[model samples]
Target: MPAPQLVWFRNDLRVADHRALAAAAAAGPVHAVFLKAEAQWAAHGVGANRLAFLERNLRALAAALGVLGIPFTVLEAPRFRDAPGTLLPWAQAQGATALHFNDEYPLNERRRDDAVARAFAQAGVAVHRYTDSVIAAPGTLKTGQGGPYTVFTPFKRRWLATLDLSSAAPLAPPDPQGPVRPLGPALEEAMTLAGAAASAVPAKLWPGGEGEAHRRLTEFLAEAALRYDSQRDFPAVTGTSTLSPYLSLGVLSPRQVLSALLAAFPDALEGSGGPSIWLSELIWREFYRHVVAAFDHVSKGEAFRPAFADLPWRQDPEGLAAWKAGRTGLPLVDAGMRELAATGWMHNRVRMAVAMFLTKNLLIDWHLGEAHFMDQLVDGDFAANNGGWQWSAATGTDAAPYFRVFNPVTQSQRFDPEGHYLRRWVPELAGLDARSIHEPWRYAGGPKAYPKPLVDLKASRERAIAHFKAHAAG
Candidate 1:
C-alpha cells in the first residue's frame, strides 16, 4: 500500500469542487485533518456565531469525507503559529508522503501556510497548494499597466473577458477509495467545545452542509433570482440568496455557484437585470479578495487609501454602544443593526446604511464598526467585512465619495417604504405611520420606548464632510 496523501482542510470544507482533496485522492490513499485554531480565530474577531457555524459544517464535512473512505481528523492548535507543530507531527506519524491544502490570502494565514510548508519539507513531505476559495486566484487578474486592479469595474471587465465557463466547470468528488473510515473521539470533543461557546447563536437559522448550500442556490435561481434586481434592496423580501455563511466557510465553492448560475441562465454573464447584477456582486467579492492579497496594508487594518488613514475619527463609547445595540434611534440603521444582532446576518443594502451611519454620521472609526461586525456576524469574512467598512467610510478603492453620507431617514423611506422591514426588526416603532416610522423623532406622541435620534443627521453629515475636507486640505 502507498503512503497516504494528507489533505489539510482550511476554509474550503465541501467535498465537491475541492481541488486539494481531489488532487490528494488522485495521488494515493487520502486522510484529512482540520486544525481547530480557536484562539487565532477569536483574535481575528471571529465570534461565537461563526465558530458555531464552523462546527456544524465541520461535522458535515467529516460525514461527506467518510463516504469517500477518507479518514478525517480534528486536531487542536490554539493559534495558526502552532499549526506546523500540530500537523507536522501528525503527518509524520501517519507516514504521509504529501500534504495538500487550498491557499488562503490573508497575511497571517499565508505566513502560517509558509511555515507549515517549510516544516513538512524538512520532514521529507511534499506540499501541494490549490487556489479553491475564489473564482479567480488572487493577483492573477492585473491591469493594463501590469498592476493589480485597485478598482472593481475594470477588474470585472477583465474577469468576464478572461473567464471561460466551460473550462471553469466544478469538479466532481473523487470515487470512493475503500471502506468508510470511522470518526474518532477528537470529533466529539471538538464539537462539544465549539457547541458550548456557540450557545448564543441558534443552529436552526442556518443548517450547514453542501446540500443546503446547493438547495439555496437552486431555490434562489428558480424563484427569487428573476426578481432579485427589483427586490434585493428591500429587506422585507426574500429576494437575495442567503448563501454567505456557506460561501465564507467554503461549504460551497465559487465554481459550483457559477456553474449552477450558468446552467440556469446560459447568458447570465452578458444578460441584464438580476443575473448580471448578482454576477457583479460575486465579482465584487473576488475584487475584495484580490485587493486583500495585493495590498498588504488592508489585511493589516490600514486604510486602502493613505489620505484617509489619519482622518481624525471621533471616539465615543456611548455612541458606539448605541450603534451596536441598535439603539441609534435612526429607524433604518437601527433596524439593520438589530437584525444583525438578532440573526447574525444583515441585508446587504442595510449593511451599507448602518455602516455609513457609524463611519459618517457617528464619526466613529471604521475599524470599530468593522470589528463589531466581525464579532457579531455569522458570515463574517475578513476580506468582505474590511472591504465593506472601508468602502462605506470612503477609505477604500471605489469608495463612496466623502460628501455622500446616506441620510438614514431618506433611505428608510425609499427602501422600506411600507415599513415592513423596520417593523419586523424594530418592533417598538411598529405602531407609527410609515412617514413617522422612518423619522420617529418627528412624530409627536409616538413610541416612548424608542430613544430619540442619536445625532442630527443633517448636522452630522455636514460635520463628516467638513472633517474629510479639512484632512484633504491639510
Candidate 2:
C-alpha cells in the first residue's frame, strides 16, 4: 500500500547505470515517463537527425523498462507547456510519492526541472535529482585559488590529480527483483504516444541503441583507440569513436566510457599523453556545461570573452548560402560542410576548419555557423557546438587568440594530405590529384566547374588578424 515512484526520463535514456531509476524503485514501485517536447526541441534547435536518434533510443529504453515491470508512458506536447504543472497531477494519479530524474545541464532543462521540483514540492511530493552525465561538475575541479578555472590545460591537469581509478567505475547492473507490479499489456483503450511520422535514419551516419554504443567502445578499445590520438585528425579515417551522439543523449554514460578506457590502459589511468588527450576532450564537454550555466549571458548568445563582441561580422546572404551549400570555393572547407550536410556529422579537425572559415574568413558570426551545425549535426551537443564555434572565433573562455587564423589550404594539406577526405565529400574533385584537390585555384579550370575561391586567402587572412589586433590594441 506504499506510494509508487515516478522516474521522469530526460537525456539519461539507459537502464544500466541509472541512479534515478534505482533510488525511485528502492523507495517504491516505479513508473516511467518520456516527454516529447516538440516545441522545446525546435527552440533548442535539435536537428531532425538527432530527434530521430532520440525516438529510437526512447523506444529501446521503453523495452528495457518494460522488463522490470515498469509501465512506460510517452507524452508529446508543444513545449514545456504543461510539464512542470502536469507532472504533479500525473504523479498523484499514478500513486507516486516522489519524482526522480537525472540531472540535465542545458539552460532550458535546468529551468524546467527547477520549476517542476518547486511544483512537486508545493504539492508535498518529494523530488530527487541524480548526476550521471559527467564524472564531476566543472566547479568540483579547481585550482588553489578557490575559483573556477577558465583555462583547459590547467583544469585538465587538476582533473588528473583529483582522480581515483577504481571509484569512477561504470555503474553495475541492479537487482530487478526490488519491486514488481504487473501493468499487463497496454489495452486497446490506452492512449497511444502520438508523434510525427517516424523517418528512416541514415545507416552510414549513426546506428542507434545502447548496444551499438557498447559495440563501438569495445571495438575502439581493441585497436582503433590507440590510433585515436594520431589519426583522429583525418576526416577520411574512422579513427574517432562515434560515441558523441550516445553520450549527448545519455545512451552511454561517461563513467562507462572512462571505465572502458582505464581497463584497457591501466598504466596511464591517472591520465597523461594519449589517454589524457582524449580525457581532456571529455572534460571540455563538461566545462562548457558549466560555462552555459555560470554565464547566463552566454546562454543568451553573449560571448564568453566580451571584448570580441565588437567583432565586425559580414552580412552576405550569397556568401552564407555558398558556405552552407558547400560552394564556398575552398575545397577543404566545402568538403567539410558537405559532409555535415550528408551525414549530419563532421570530423572534429575540419569542424574547426569550417567554423574558422565562417567566422574568420567570411567574417560571419560564429553563432551563425553554430546554429547551422545544431540544425544538422546528429550528435549536436549545445555545449560542444557552442564551445567549438566560440573557441575557433576566439570569443569564448579559454578560447584561442584571434590572431591565430587557420589557412584553409595549408590546414587541408597537413591534415587530409592525400585529398582522400575532400574527394569523398566533394565528388567533383574526386578525379583530381592530391595537390590540386586541396587548392584547386592553383590548377587551371579547377575541379571541372567547381566555383573559384570566394575571396583571396592572403587578403582575408590579413584582414582577420588585423581586425582582432585592432580590437585588442584599442
Candidate 3:
C-alpha cells in the first residue's frame, strides 16, 4: 500500500504557509477532509449568518484544493460525541498511516482533539498536530516567575519585545499542481447548502474565500494602513482593516496579516500611528488566547479572576430584545445595535461602547450580551467575545474598572460627531442636524417616531458603580 497522510481541515483552512499540509504532502500522497460538525455548531448557537458565510468559504477552499490536484472530501460528523471512533474506521478504510492537523483552543475542541489523539495511538497511527492559530502558541510567553499573565499591558509589552522578524515575513500561496497519486473523490458543482439555508447575503456585506482575503490584504496595505489610527474610531468612516471575518474563519492567517502590515509600515509597528495601534489590537487577540489557555475555567464560564463571580447582573429578556433590535433609545447604542441586526457586523469602537452599555449601563449579565454578539457578529470567536464582554463588565482579568463608565452622549458626540452612522442605521434621525441627532431627546420635537432614552445614563452609571463598590467592600 502507498503511504498516505490524512489532512483534517479545521479553522486553519487556507493553504498559505499551512505547516500541517506542507509537512503531510511532503511525506506522501495527501487526502484532505473537512468534518462538518453540524450538531456541534448548532448547539453552540452558530447563527445561520455565520454558517452561510462558512459554506461560501468552504466552497472557495474546495476549488483551490482541486486546482492543486488534491482530492477534497467533506464528511458529516454531527457533534463530537463519537468523532475519534467514527473517524478512525473511515481513515482505516482509506488505509491512512499518519494523521496531520492544526490545534484547536476552545474547551470542547480541546477535549475532542485529546480523544482523537488517543484513538489514533491505539490504532498505531501517529497524529501530528501543528500550530497555525496564532503568531505564538499559548504558554510560549510568561512572566519571570513563570506564571500566566493576568494583565494585558505587561504581556503586550513583553510580546512586542520578543517579536521575531523572520516568522512575520510574508509566505507564498500554496502551489497544489504537482505529481501525486489519486487520493479521494473530486468536488462536484451541485454540492450546495446543507439545510434550510437563509436568504442570499447582501452584495456589500463582506467578500468570502482566500482569493478575496488576499485581495483585501493588498488593498488595505495600499490605502488604509496610513490612516488606521486617526480614522478607525469613526463608525461612519471606512478606516479600519475589516479583516476580522476572514481571520475568524481562518480564511486568512494572522501571519499573513502581520506580514503585510509590517511590509506596508515597517516603522508603524513601533511608532505612534494607526499601524502601531492596529498592531496593538492584534496583540490583544494574542493576549486573550493566552488568558483562555492559562485559565481553563474561562472556557467553562467561570470568571478569569474568580472574585468577579458575584457581580450583580439583571438577566432581563425584554431589555435584551431592545438592546439586540437597535431600539435601546440611545442613538449611538441603537445605531450600533441596528448595524449588527441588519448586517451581522458592527464597528469596533462602537462594539466596545455598546458592550459597555449592556454590561455596565443596563447592569445586565455580560454573558447574555456576549451570546447575543456571537449570534450577530460575523467575526465572532468564543474566546474573543467572552474576553471582551467580561472585560467590559469588569469581571475578567485586567477588566475595565467599574468607575470608568462611558457616558453614551459624550461618546456619540466624540466618535460619530456628524451622526453619519446613526443616520445610516436609524434613518428616522437622518433629518435631524448632527447636534440633535446624537441626543434626540434634547430637541423639543425630537424626531417623531424614535423612542426616548430607555434608561437614564447618569442614574444607571451611579447604580453600576455603587453595585461594584459595595460588592468589593462586602
| RMSD to native, candidate 1 | 1.2
Candidate 2 wrongly placed segments (more than 4 Å): 177-204, 271-273
User: For candidate 2, which ten residues in a row score worst on lDDT?
Assistant: 187-196
Candidate 2 lDDT over 1-474, as tens digits, reads 677788898888888877788788778777788776877878877777777677667767766776676777766555775687667777888878899998777677788889999999998889998877877764577668887777787877777677665656676544563354443455211222333223234744576678888998898778677766787788889888888989999889988888888778875455455665676778788778867766677777778887887777878889899999999899999999988888888889899998988888888888889989988887888888888999999999898788788888999999989999988988889889988888887888786669998988889988888888888777
Superposition TM-score, candidate 2 onto the true structure: 0.93
On lDDT, who's better, 2 or 3?
A: 3
Q: Which tens-of-lDDT digit does each residue in 120-139 have in candidate 1? A: 99988999999888878888
How close is every model to the real structure, measured as TM-score? Answer: 0.98, 0.93, 0.95
Highest TM-score model number:
1
lDDT values of the candidates? Answer: 0.89, 0.79, 0.81
Per-prediction RMSD in angstroms?
A: 1.2, 2.6, 2.3
Better of 1 and 3 by TM-score: 1
Q: For model 2, what is the error of residue 16's alpha carbon versus the real structure, in angstroms, after optimal superposition?
A: 0.9
How displaced is residue 96 in candidate 1, in Å?
0.8
Clashes of 1: 0
The lDDT of model 2 is 0.79
